[model samples]
Target: MNKELWEKAVAFHGHACPGLALGVRLCEFVQQELGVGVSPDEELVCIAETDSCPVDAVQAILGCTMGKGNLLCSRAGKTAYNFYDRGTGTSIRVVARRNTAELSREERRRQILESPLEDLFSTTEVKYPLPETARIFKTVTCAVCGEGVAEHMARLQDGGIVCPHCFRAYDR
Candidate 1:
């Protein structure tokens, strides 16, 4: 990983934690594996298994952002990521070593920042389709909450569009 890139990541993530360092290394490995660099647009997609400090690094270095509809989170609470090339359909999954969990947060961060690439993570190639629903959505106004909701996320309740939150409220 480039020192300059790590600096940039630290600047973006607002700290120099282990998760951020791991993400920086993951981005570097992914770029090398796919023979590509930071995406100019939606050329690459990152599916992170958890919402953690590393996610910010992936966003900064890989050019996959939630606003762009390219960064997806799995909410699995694991430090794993899947990088997919939209143009070639190639993807790779990277997971941090489980033993890292044994270390204190500060020690883990220190190790991640100082360790070699191979020592920090295990990676594998995978095949998975980018969902059609991932890219496009229609915006609608929820009648109950009056908040804007994606059409796919809105439900029809009492002959009016309602967001999941509002719908759940009605249910309760």
Candidate 2:
């Protein structure tokens, strides 16, 4: 990871590159720096710190890694082993490509963890709320008919919420 470039990307993402801004930040990084459209199979060259879990730390930035890098991890210097099945020569959740740059939504959350954050957030964090929850209307039953009733003829003539069929007597 180029500290300058990494910091630049972080700044472009408004500090953390935040929740969904990962892709947008990557696009900006590629466009402004790589000068090429991301092919989804692009490999990004990164500089890992001397004492970090390369896979866990860089996961969010690179999307994923082979897990078994010949080079010992920069942080712990441990040989990271990617898991494989007994019969199948396959590792689950292996990052097939390096993509710190792509659309925001398709981003694997790992990249979010590896991203360098200095500008937007710090030890301090703020939580944002979700959009308002819309109320769902269920079937309201008529007391007299004992059947599910809706406001077919109902009107708010009084301070209460009465079904249309029941409102008739009140209206009269």
Q: Could you say which candidate leads in lDDT?
A: 1
lDDT of 1 by residue, 44-75 (tens): 88888899998999888888888888888888
Q: Which 10-residue window of candidate 1 scores lowest in summed lDDT?
A: 126-135
Clashes of 2: 12
Q: Model 2 — TM-score against the truth? A: 0.19
Which parts of model 2 are misplaced by more than 4 Å? Answer: 1-27, 36-43, 50-172
The regions of model 1 sitting more than 4 angstroms off are: 100-107, 125-128, 133-136, 169-172
**Per-prediction TM-score, please?**
0.86, 0.19
Q: What are the clashing pairs of model 1?
A: 18-109
